[model samples]
Target: MVAPDERIGPAQTGALRLRLSLFYAGFFAFLGVQQPFWPVWLASHGLGATEIGVILALSIGIKMFSAPLAAHGADRSGQRRRSILVLVAGSLAAFCLFALTNGFWPILLISVLFYALWPPVMSLTESLTIMAVQRASLDYGRTRLWGSTSFIVVALLSGQVLVWLPPSAILWLSLACVAATAAACLFLPDIRTERSPLHRGLPIVQALRIRALSLSLAACGLIQGSHAVYYAFGTLHWQAKGYSENVIGVLWAEGVLAEIVLFAYGGRVTRHLGSVGLITLAGIAAVVRWLGTGLTDSLAAVVVLQALHAFSFGAAHLGAMACIGETVPASLSATAQSLYSGLVWGAGLGLMLLASGWLYHGLGGSAYLAMAAVALAGTFVALRLSALTPRLPQP
Candidate 1:
């Protein structure tokens, strides 16, 4: 893969957007199935809660290093789509190993390899989407909304499917998504970005010298990282509080539904408020969301408050993307995306998740107080980011 000297025409852009959308839809559709239900499958295999938690934590922790390594290779090769295909294939093979083994150690070893390759796909794909967004003058939120939509669809549908099928069927369902994503990659436009002399083929450390890039990444990561407690224990907490399984599921679905609405109108939201303001809104909403979550036992209130996930996750992410678009150079795009994924989502959230288990054990719903504080700090960081905007000039 080599970077082109000039941007392509719209006819190509339109086609690439559809293919990219399909790729995201297929990939995240699998995530929708995997995240919530994989544990159920693990439990069905007789893995204890401790074993399951360790496996999940290990899988997430591995990505802090693995994703960045994978992104570095993709950037060096300038072949993001090709990198994704390899990861999908490698992960699928690992999943097969998981299927053949029921023992704890075998499953753990295979899971490590599987997760190391798989998590990088999104960071790498985001880089591709960013490049395409730059070349095509597209809307990132609108395009990414398709992935969220697919996530919701698969999550709901797979729940029903799981009721009818055996637990072991999850691996096959995951494989189908991997295969579909690989096929979609085949249709991706064969495009690469030319190296910028400004970047001077420098390392990621040098890329971080840009204050806006680093600050924005940190802020967005914290905002995203704040979701750790909610993701890990939200269902169990609700269940213990006497909410039925179906109701707890709706609470989860409500958040995603709100996120979809936010993304669907994301362009309008960004245009009305601007990027910095949008991120600030996300931070403030997160504060309220988590605090309310900690304090409330009112089901009606939780339902309404769950809508705040839209601002918390969606707007904070769009703000980060906007910052990267305006501040980071195209040459450093892949590095920046991976940094957000590896550091923010992978390492930062992984640590928070570990803490959440302890907190949930000790304080139950009051565990959310810590998450609220986390979001509050992130809110302040986003405000700082708003004040420090710097654009990267084309070389």
Candidate 2:
């Protein structure tokens, strides 16, 4: 475990905070460009909806296996930062392979490699930031907010850039952003935590035996993965409804902006509401959000529901991270984080996305109703999780 003092601190932790914030900002900026535009770019290359879903699913699915491998490497070597840099470099190379070819099989192969190299970066980075906060007395939200802000900037600007340039530019933009992330990685301080010789790495079986974590992951995964319908098809839906590219950008930015605000106040919210309550709230919001998204066609109604992203995504994410951070040991932090990301975010999400693609083809807008049902199921899990686990002490 990190020393108690290392976990909580005053707002200003000096230069380390600034450096870490910049690193996250650059990394998330890359994601902002990729997440919202990558599908659109794939479409331009002649991939159908199902194919697009498959490709995206494949990319994410690889993370299920890859994240654990990366975490194991980091844990065994006790070189978190170095492992992250190596993976980032590997991802860059894989993406470069994507740029060189438009062939389906080649791109698919590259997609797997690209995603395989990608998952560890975020998990390890979070572990690093948490360590820094523990050691230096810094605010996680204040430091992490830079990434959200950078994402907003990129989302908005990339919209305008896409308007003036071809869709092909999306790849270039992604490459540029990742390059910037690499530069930022160079500035992070190398801080090692107290290693436990008794370190029994993440007992996957034992952790799974903890019914709350397992159930929470399942519920959260389905609820969150339900967004695959939105993530994969929302922009297309909006476009089919006659919205412009710029309007789509605004909509995307609005959700992320709400996410930013949630993160900024996350610590306080966690303190006040606790993880179970917050996650329950998020699950409830997702039910309403997805159902409203399915029931309404009005632009105003759509915007209102998108704003609910603050709770559905932002709050739920905060709850999960806090839960994982608290329950997992320092030695197994990376592995646990990866497990959450891999099993829930990667596997659960991938399957749902694939299903959503088929549903979109068969049912059009009504497919989101299925997504709402998934969210409702997740709400039950969240409530159950609250009942099962003991709340950890707050900072």
Most accurate candidate by TM-score? 1
- Give lDDT tens digits, candidate 1, residues 266-286: 767776776677778888999
Consecutive 10-residue window with the lowest summed lDDT within model 2? 1-10
Clashing pairs in 1: 3-192, 3-193
Give each model's clash number.
Answer: 2, 2
Encode model 2's per-residue lDDT on 348-382: one tens digit a residue: 78888878878999978888899988888989988
lDDT of the structure predicted as candidate 2? 0.78
lDDT accuracy of residue 91 in candidate 1: 74
- TM-score of every candidate: 0.93, 0.88
